[model samples]
Target: MSVRTQESALRIALVFPGQGAQHPRMAAGLYGHEAVFTAAMDEALELLGADGERIRSAWLARTTTADFDDVTVSQPLLYAVDHALGRMVLDWGVEPVALMGHSVGELVAATLAGVVGFADGIRLMRARIRQFAQTPAGGMLAVAAGLGEVEDLLTGQVHLAAVNARRQLLLAGEREPLDRAAQALRERGIVCRDARARQAFHSPVVDEAVEASMPDWLATPLNRPRRTVYSAYTQGVLTDDTALDHRFWARQAAETVHFAPTLDRLLADHDCLLVEAGPGNSLSTVARRHPAVVRGGSEVAPLLPDGAQDDVRDRRSVAAAKERILPLQQPVRA
Candidate 1:
């Protein structure tokens, strides 16, 4: 495709993630290219009084998926990488018409959208990590040939976390009941597996944690966003500072994410270019499942000029896209 055509077709939507996407080396390439991103990461480490280098190296390390499963470490690191990448993309001048963050990734999305300052977002992440850390939680996995059937299977012990599609669902709660539910699904020939996550994030268990952290989160200042930021909690476009309330943040931790609802609402009016702004490719994978959306860039070195390539980790074919990164600008609007 020609550059002009590609650019014209770009109606970007910046999508942020919650958890389950992190690695030590996720954003190493952008360290030099996007210093502000690096600075944001450094600030995150400073908040914890830990070595940033060690943290980066830990994520970059090639290890089993289990190695990166700790909620405390994963949450902050995910934010760092996503925030860094989001800044790099904005610097590249690829403005999105809309922004949506999944779970914790919402903070990164809000930061990039100008809804919240970077530093404050990082601070909130730190507090959020601590607040939600104490609660005991676990995640569920199921591949449903039929999603409707599984709805009846959810018990009080387990709750739906994410709806990846009409056919895929994520359940969260205590471990034993979740395992039993998985076994039941398996009996039905549904593909169900346990997620690597230790915490049942986005469930009722985290309500107290979120509530304790709310006064502090709300105290964090709000800034005007560059683009419209939609909230999964509200399932609508966020237009005011009041959007960042206790109920919103609390529900983010305690409620199941109706991603389909949020995505459906956003895609209806906009020709969206969905950019998964984070370390791992989970959000991007989810976006690809939707026929209406397309990917922006990935993590490999020297992909897009102004460091856009490092801003996102494109799980697409790297072998075919080794061309030197190109400098880009906003295409003229129709």
Candidate 2:
């Protein structure tokens, strides 16, 4: 295909990974190295108040102020990093056809799309922490098996949490029960790993907590997305009404995430250059398994290094992605 033909066929979609993608000091490489990203991230942290400062400290120091998956640190830091990266992408002059996010990343998508103000999004996350405080302590498990293969194992406390890709599934439950479930899956020769989660999100354990937090929202009217925003939770394009539904947001953690189905729908709409605009490359890793990407109908770019802190490498990755998306325009770096 000619350059023009290939460019014409491109439909860019910015995808953000959620909770489990967080690591100690994730995306530290880009903290002060990239101007646009640094400013946006700082703004996000500032809105988060004192807690944001603490999170920033840990992130920059490559240490943890609390459990890596604790709601206080992980959720806020992940949200800030993902949001900042999205802003950086927008600054590149490339318009995304859609914004999609997994789990908490969906809120980041919603914030960027104008469905909710950024501060309001942060408040909702805070409310989530407060409300879930009373719930039973729980966690999530990442399993390398299809839902159909493991659905029967979810008992009273255990439940299917998320469908990341074709065979990658997530299970959530109270800690003890989740551990038992993992053991059972292992006995059946299925690979399983504990997700970095301090709570059993997307499980019944948090249902009542979610219900109690439904009223926790500002009176500010929700806005329509400036661009298309696909929802992993609903597995469809998010409607304006759903965006305005506080109850819907409240029940998010008590429901399963249909990320794979949503990705299928997003891809069916058009082939895309799927960019991972968050810490690590988990979503990009998942997207690579999709048929269109494997068939060369789509491309994927992850902006940060996967396993370690490398400021220079991070800048190079962003610069590389910038070139891939906008060859004629020079990036802020390189």
Candidate 3:
């Protein structure tokens, strides 16, 4: 469809979850049951090559991984699952007003937006996982406080990784420093949760590590997105410069995600349904806190149940999510 026609379509915004949102058996139920989802997931994993095989085996076997958060496992898996879920939504005949994602989730959205091809994204992520794997052991923690409340707690190693919501923040750093910071928060009566991650993503410690990506980025094909995209990295609508900027993708792992502001920009433009197409309700939870949603001017739909829920069937959740978005599209378009 033409850009003008696409712009005139219904306003449905998809928000993708980043790292730490993963868990065992996420979307496993859809592997054989749902055609679109199954095909998309299979295609992505196949493109992932060897690592894809490993992930697929473990997922189907339902093996409990000791370090499920490690980038090698988490990144590729999330990319595949998120991408598949996004494709499933599109299959429902919904056209999003824009696409937005948090952290690595941005890459998933970019892939769907045609900013990067599926095979190329697989290449970039595989290369990224290898590079990130070499970094020193580190961790990420979600703290329930604004930067003002936690700025003094940050060290050279432990820095702000993400601003997820008004008071929801994430910190990343080498193991000890991040743990120490988390301890401090706990002592101060602030709640903090560990991310299922081993690499201190978005930390400067990885800045040099990402430098090696210059060649990879240059070698990879880059293109402007055919669809409107919002970037948490840029805290605004994605521009051609940002989309095609090799440096941005290269440095993404070490840069803080400004998800709150990015979502604000999207909602400011259109009162759309927010569908989180990922493993968990992390993005959905954050979206609920927005005033537009709370006042019923906007809505939030989750494509999957929380990773914490062992009984929630992913396929059923997809059906439920479909019902939520499809019914609302006509009203929003009106």
The estimated TM-scores of all candidates read: 0.82, 0.93, 0.93
Q: Write the per-residue lDDT of candidate 2 for residues 1-334, one digit (tens) a residue.
A: 4463534466778999888888776777777877888898888777777677777776776555566677767877888889889888888887788899998889889888998888887777666667876788899999999978887888677999999998999999999999999999999999999998888888898889877776775444588788899998879999988888877776787899999999999998877889898888889999999998898878788877785676777788788888777752332211
How would you encode candidate 3's per-residue C-alpha lDDT over 1-334 as one tens digit per residue?
A: 2332333433689989989888888888777777888999888788888888887765565655765778888888888888988998888888787999988889989988999888888888888778888899888999999899999988586899999898999999988888899889999999998987888888897887789777888888889998899988888888998998998888898999999989988988887789999888999999999998887667888988887334347777887888777864553434
What TM-score would candidate 3 get against the native? 0.93
User: How many backbone clashes are present in model 2?
Assistant: 0
Per-residue lDDT tens digits of candidate 1, residues 18-96? 6765545666665555566677777777765543455555665655345366666677787887777676566656666
Query: Which residue pairs show backbone clashes in model 2?
Result: none
* Candidate 1 TM-score, true structure as reference: 0.82
Each candidate's lDDT (Cα)?
Answer: 0.65, 0.82, 0.84
Model 2 per-residue lDDT at 45: 77
Clashes of each: 11, 0, 0
Pairwise TM-score winner, candidates 1 and 2: 2
Which stretches in model 3 have alpha-carbon errors above 4 Å? 1-10, 308-312, 331-334
The candidate maximizing lDDT is: 3
